[model samples]
Target chain A: MKIAIVGSGAIGLYYGALLQRNGHEVAFLMRSDLEVAKRDGVRVIRTDDEFTLDRVAAFGDSEEIGVSDLVIVSIKATANQSLPKMLDPLVDETTQLLTLQNGLGNDQFLKARFPNNKVFGGLCFVCLNRIAPAVVKNFMKGSVSIGPSDGADASEAETLVSVFSEAGVKARFEPDLLGIQWKKLVWNVPFNGLAIAAGGVCTDVIVESPELCSEAKALMEEIMAAANQFGYTFRDGFADYQIEITQPMGPYRPSSMIDFVEGRPVEVEAIWGEPLRQAKAAGVAMPKLEMLYALLKRICK
Target chain B: MKIAIVGSGAIGLYYGALLQRNGHEVAFLMRSDLEVAKRDGVRVIRTDDEFTLDRVAAFGDSEEIGVSDLVIVSIKATANQSLPKMLDPLVDETTQLLTLQNGLGNDQFLKARFPNNKVFGGLCFVCLNRIAPAVVKNFMKGSVSIGPSDGADASEAETLVSVFSEAGVKARFEPDLLGIQWKKLVWNVPFNGLAIAAGGVCTDVIVESPELCSEAKALMEEIMAAANQFGYTFRDGFADYQIEITQPMGPYRPSSMIDFVEGRPVEVEAIWGEPLRQAKAAGVAMPKLEMLYALLKRICK
Candidate 1:
């Protein structure tokens, strides 16, 4: 399979390199890391295994990687405006467009822009960071949940999951795309938003403070409530499970927090704004998420 | 009236100096600013008028100030624990106690500590800062509202208002202490909390952004809702009025925000926590205030 990786940040570089190692022809669309990818060629540093694709194809222009079988978008949602132009050269009628971006609306955005291509969305439950140019670090290689967006077939999402599995990754296909998004947001809305909103602290700080912990759970409950309006029901104690799972990720910097601290544009619209809007439109009141969204927009701006 | 001012922050210095300049014997119970106050007295710099009280008595210990006709408590709510000890020497059965602190519960604390003494609570609507030791700058000399706590008489509050009015301060006698606190919190909870929570901004920053402006209004509405449960009703468009009045202040930092940015303890309990607890007890749901209180507790901690 020939795959084109767009917005080659940490998720893009790590996953793209893995697919390339598994014999898939992978080409990365790079920006600041283009020269580094050509010279050092995308290094993935993990605790157990470290590898580098020394001479993989890296292009500055999307047209050079034209018409791939699969196009994986891992860009920050702040730069979603460039998606149509970038994906135009790589997307064909048969090409599957999988967005590995955070928050809601990315898959919807892709589906709207490239109506002919099959659109899928994947939520990466991994702790990965690009330490330096073309140099990726994986603190936790968690699984990925791939789901077909509206009008996309479930079997296509399953095929993409199998592709990830072949590259030594834990990937699962989810039929309900919106449900999976709310589930992921149950964690992201609080942890990612609070990490920056609570003065650039980390998961540990939030989990340690009783006030912050309860606030996080409240945010999760609000997300769950909004999800319920869309026919998605979370089991009782889901919010507790989310907090419990985050306890071990001590002082972990969320990707959004990293973006905010490093002076990069955050995906405020996609992550916080869109969810609040969708929840309101569904007639579900998410006061906590709404306030958090307002704060994030102000801080990120 | 012979008055003793405790915790000589901006509010303490400005008001205390005014009374002393008006020929009343005013003694300041100071800490770091004791020497400066004793040397150069206290200076109040305002847009219209500036005055200095030279050779005024400045005592490091409240005991040295002795029992006074009135004792003004101007400390941060974070230091409320030290009240009993500090007030012991300065407060007698005839010594009236007036707490000009932000938020709720200060008057209650005083009433509990000194049951025989008349307890009064004053909410100062001013923009004042202690720029240097014993030197206070007042950008706006907004009025103060005084009201008696439980068991205190309305006439007593009126007398305190006269004391303030004698010193050329625009002081009003409010019959409802809790109502005034809630009314002030309609502005404080969002403006003060967001100023710190939104990366240490000012009132202008909160008013400028549409998201933040709406958030401030929502917070005000939540406060009004809670106030309604307690038989307090605000005028229509009160939130808009709060924002409109704040717009002309242009980047004015709230006292709590100043405390946070200067590495001093903020009055999280008095300003946010106590009100939230009280509102919940009153069967009023204030999700915005609850979340803001949580963020403030974590950030200020």
Candidate 2:
């Protein structure tokens, strides 16, 4: 399979490297920080393996790379507004565009940009951070969910699953991609948002203050309630699952916290602002989440 | 009049030195940091004047201070637990204790410890931070409220006004001290807790996020509602006054934020926890206050 990984950050590079290692032809469509990878290639440090590809093709201009069978858009959520222009050269009639980004509204953004490009929502449930240029570190092992954003066919989902499976990455197809997206959102809306707002590790917050734990729980409940009001029924104990998964990650600061610490622009609008807007549109009052979103946006601005 | 200042932190030292300079004969019962003041005397850096005292009496033991006509207790709320022991040697039949500490329960603690002594609730509206031992940097000038905790007498209140006026500290004797305490609590409950929980400056939280600002306001409303439930009528626009006073502080981090940054124990239980417990006991549901209290307790632990 010919695959083009767009915006080759840690996640994009990880998937691209794994697919290339599995004998699938893969190339990265990068913007910045490609010079280091071009010099030293892509280095991935996983739990069970460490590998580097010395001669992988990397491009700063997306137009230099021709369209492939699969195009993975894995940029930060803040970059979504410029995504259509960035990926203009990589979208053909048969190219399946998958958005593997955090926060809400990315799928919608992609769908609005490429209505007929078989856009699918892809969520990576793992902890990965870019240690350096072209250097990827994975701290957790989790699967990915890929499904049609417009809820039509399963062909793109199956192809994505097969492509990922061949590269030893577990990927599943969910018919209700919106639910999966909201579920992933439910995890982030509270944990990442609150963690960023509080400026501490997740487990440290849960362990140190019962009030924070309950507030985190309440924020999740508010998100769930908003989703339910929109006729989306989450899996039972989804909030608990999020809290459980996050608790053991031990003193790990969320990306939002890192963004604040680094003084970088954060994805406040996507992760918090959009869902809060949706909740308001749906007439669900989410005091905790609303507060978290407001605080994050304030710091970001 | 002879006056004793207990727990000479920034506030204590500032007011103590000022009172002494005004010829009221002020003495400080301090901890280890006061040895320098005993040697080189106290220094106060105010906007209009900067001077050093050459002869300031500083004692490590409260027993050496003896009984005084007035005692100013200016310590953090965390120190309230051991306050009685610290004030033991300074209380006589005619002694009056004035509490100028943050958070709720200081007056209650002092009153419980010395039921016979005239205990007055004092709320300092000034902003000052310790620049060094025996040195305080005054950032803002504001009034202090002194009144009876039980609302039973005006004689002690008048004495406090005279004492404070003689000392050059703006002080008012309110007939309803409980109302004043509640008003202060309204600001402390939201700003202190939110600033600590969010791990950011107050202005950052309030200005950057309307949601956070609203949440804070909602929490203040909850506190106000709880006060009303107890048959306490707060001054109109107390909440608005809080917003007005806090917004201009300009990116200033509160003591709780400082505590989190410095990894010291916070006064969450005294400020938010106790009020929440009282509200719950009174059958008033203060969801915002309760949430803030719970979050602060969790993060502090």
Candidate 3:
């Protein structure tokens, strides 16, 4: 399989590394680290198996990468406007473009850009960070739930999952990818929003404050309520479920907080704003997400 | 009239200076600035008239100030826990205490502490900063809406207004003080919370961001909704009304933002938490205020 990673961030690097090790031809659509990656491999720091891979090709221009079997769109959603133009040289009719990005509108965005190409979405359940240029730290999970965003019953997703599984990645095909995205947002809207809202405090600060915890839970409930309007009903106590899973991370700050600290623009548009927009379009009153989106917009870009 | 100004911070000092200039026997219950105020007196650095009055007495202990006819409690609501003990010596049976403080619960707090005394609230529409110990800069207005908080029409409130008026302060007695508190909160919860939520940016930034302005306006509507449940139905577009008044302030930072910047504890309990509690009691859902209160609790305290 010839696979190309769209953006060389954490998810892009980690998965691309695995795919490359599995004997797939992988190319990275590189940025400023283009020279460094070409000189010395992209480094993956892990407790079990840490290695640097210089075997894969790194291309600064999308034209140099050419059309591939799979193009994983892992760029920050803040850069969505440029994705069409950036990926134009690489996407063809048979190109299976899988977005491992955050937010609701990416599939529509890509579809609008390349009408004939098969656009897939993967909710990458991962906690990783790109600490330095061409270097990524996989702190935890890298499982992906993949499916076709255009409502196609995907035997195509199964083939993609096999390639991912061969690379030692946990991959599964879900028929309801949009529902999974909504489920991800139940956690994303509250935890990511609250972390930034409290001026970049971590999970420990949230758990310690009863009001914050309840507010987090309430935001999750609000997300579920908004989902229900779109005929997507999550289980009861979904917020608590997220908290129980996240509590083990122990004083961890999420990606939005990390962006805030580094003076980088946050992906609030993709993660917070779009969901609120969809909720409003559905005539759902997600007051919490509305306020969170507003706050994030004011603080971030 | 013999008046003792408790909590000699910016609000206390500025208003107390006006009273002293009006020939009232004013004794300041000073904090860390006792020595400086005693040496050079509290300085009012106004553009029109900046003066240092040495004739007014300044005392460190409330016991030294003794029981006065009127005790203007201009302390931060964060100091409410100590009010019972601190104001014990200064508040007597006839000591009409006017709380020129922020938030909803100041009168109730003082009433809780000094049950025998007349407890009133002054929703001060002022913008001033204490640049140094006992030195306050009046940047803008000093109009106070004075009234009884417990829905009692007391004649003392009218007298208090007259004294405040004579002291060159724009003072008026509002029979419905709690409603005014809610109206003020329509402004407070948005500006104060948004300022800190935007990483401590001022009003200029908030006004510039369309998302923030709409969010602030939405929060105001939520507050009015909550107030309506308590039989306080304010007119429609109250949010717009407040914004029009605040837009001219030009890059202003509210008191809560200042408190947050100085690392002083914010009055989340009085300003945010109590109103939320009341809203909940009235079976109202103020999701915006709840989230703001939670964020403020995590960051400020």
Candidate 4:
């Protein structure tokens, strides 16, 4: 299989290295790391395994990596605005695009931009970071949650899942992708929003402060309530379950916190804004979320 | 009448300087600023006038100052925890205590400690900052809203009012002091909470972001509604009225912003925590304020 990684960030590099190690021809759509990745290849440090691809194709311009079987759009959600212009060149007749980014509207945005091609959304359930150029740090072993986007057949997603699962990624298909996205939001909006708005700390720092930890839980409940308004519901204690799981992660900086510390604008619109708009349009009372969105919109930009 | 100024920060020094200039025997109950103030009196740079009192009494130990007719508690709301110990030595039989700090419960807290003395809560409607050791910068001139804390005779507040007004400060005694405190909170909770939570920007920065400004208004309205539950209702458009008045201030950092920036723990309890608790106890929904309080309690301490 031939694959093109639209973003050379940690998620893309990690997955790309895994697939490349599995004997697939993988090319990276890079910016500053283009030359370095091509010269020395991408290195990934996973908890259970560590590997480096000796030589891989890299392109600073997406047009140069034209016509791949799979195009993984793994850029930051803040970079989604450039989808049409950047992804336009790499997709071809047989290319199936997969959006592996955070927040709500990625699949919709990518599908709209690549109308003639199939686009699936991939949620990376992993804590990873690119510590340096062309290098990825995998904090824990995790899987990719895959699903077909609108206009895409379900079977098309299986091949990629099998490829990922075979490469030890534990990838699985989430038939209810939209439901998965909202479920992910139950954790994302509160944790990510609190991390950024509350002095750009990590999950560990958040829980260390009892008040913040409570607010984190309150925010989660609010998000769940909003999701229920649009026909998506989670069982009782789901929010508490997330907190119990997160408490042991030990000072993890979610992507939004990273954006803030690096002085980059956050993906507030994708993660919080869109969901808030949907809640209000559906006549749901999501005051906590409305507050989060309002504060973050000002704080991020 | 003899006056002792406690917690001599910006507001303390400004009022102390004004009263000292008006021929009162003013002694400052100081902490770190005690030495400098004694060496070269308290200096103030008002918009209309600037002066340095060449000779003024300053004492770190409240016991040294003995008792007085008036004791103005002008410290940061965060430091109110020391009032019982620090202000104890400065009160006498006729020593009327006045609290001129930010937030909600200073009056309650002080009155509880100094049950023997008449207590008044003074809302200083002025923008001021402590620029140097003993110097304060006055950005604008406004009246101090004076009110009795414990249903004491209104005239107890008038003594300080007359002194303040005589020293070129606008002072008025409100028969409904609790009502004034609640009304002031209608603006304080949102502006202060937001300034700290939204990256410590000032009021002007908040209003510049249309989303933030609107959220500021929404939070204000929520607080007003909460206030109304306790029978302290404002006229219609009060929230908008606050916004229109605040927009022209040009990025002024509210006290909470200063505290966060200076690495001081914010006065979350007095300004937000107390009010949020009250709102919930009354069965009033103030989700926005609750959210703000939770985040701030974590971020501040």
Give interface RMSD for all predictions: 1.0, 2.7, 1.1, 1.4
Q: Quality of candidate 2's docking, in CAPRI categories?
A: acceptable
Q: lDDT for every model?
A: 0.91, 0.78, 0.83, 0.83
lDDT of 2 by residue, B1-301 (tens): 7889997887898888888888887879888567888888988887788889888989988888888888999877887777778788888978988888877788888888888878888888787777787887776768888888773368868877877787788888887776676667787777777777665465556644566677778888888887887667767887777778877777766666766666877888777887788878988877677556665665676
lDDT of 4 by residue, A1-301 (tens): 8899988888889898988888889889888788888788899997777888889888888888878888888888888777778877777777888988888889998777778888898888788888888999988776788998877878888877898898778889877677778888887898899898887889998777777787788778777877787677788889889888888778888877887888877888999998888777878777788788888887887
* Residue A136 shift from truth in candidate 1, angstroms: 2.6
Q: Tens-digit lDDT track for model 1 on A114-159?
A: 8888999999989888999999999888999999999999998999
Clashing pairs in 1: none
3 or 4: which has the higher TM-score? 4
Which residues of candidate 4, in runs, are more than 4 Å off? none
Report the lDDT of model 4 for residue B277.
83
Q: DockQ (Cα-based) per candidate? A: 0.74, 0.39, 0.75, 0.73
Clashing pairs in 2: A208-B298, A208-B301, A209-B298, A210-B298, A211-B294, A211-B295, A212-B295, A298-B208
Output the TM-score of candidate 4: 0.94
TM-score (chain A only) of candidate 3: 0.95
Model 2, position A228, has a per-residue lDDT of 86
What is the fnat value (0 to 1) for candidate 1?
Answer: 0.74
Cand. 2 Cα-lDDT? 0.78
- Backbone clashes in model 3, listed as residue pairs: none
State the lDDT at A186 in candidate 4.
81
Q: Arrange candidates by DockQ, descending.
A: 3, 1, 4, 2
User: For model 4, what is the error of residue A144's alpha carbon versus the real structure, in angstroms, after optimal superposition?
Assistant: 2.1
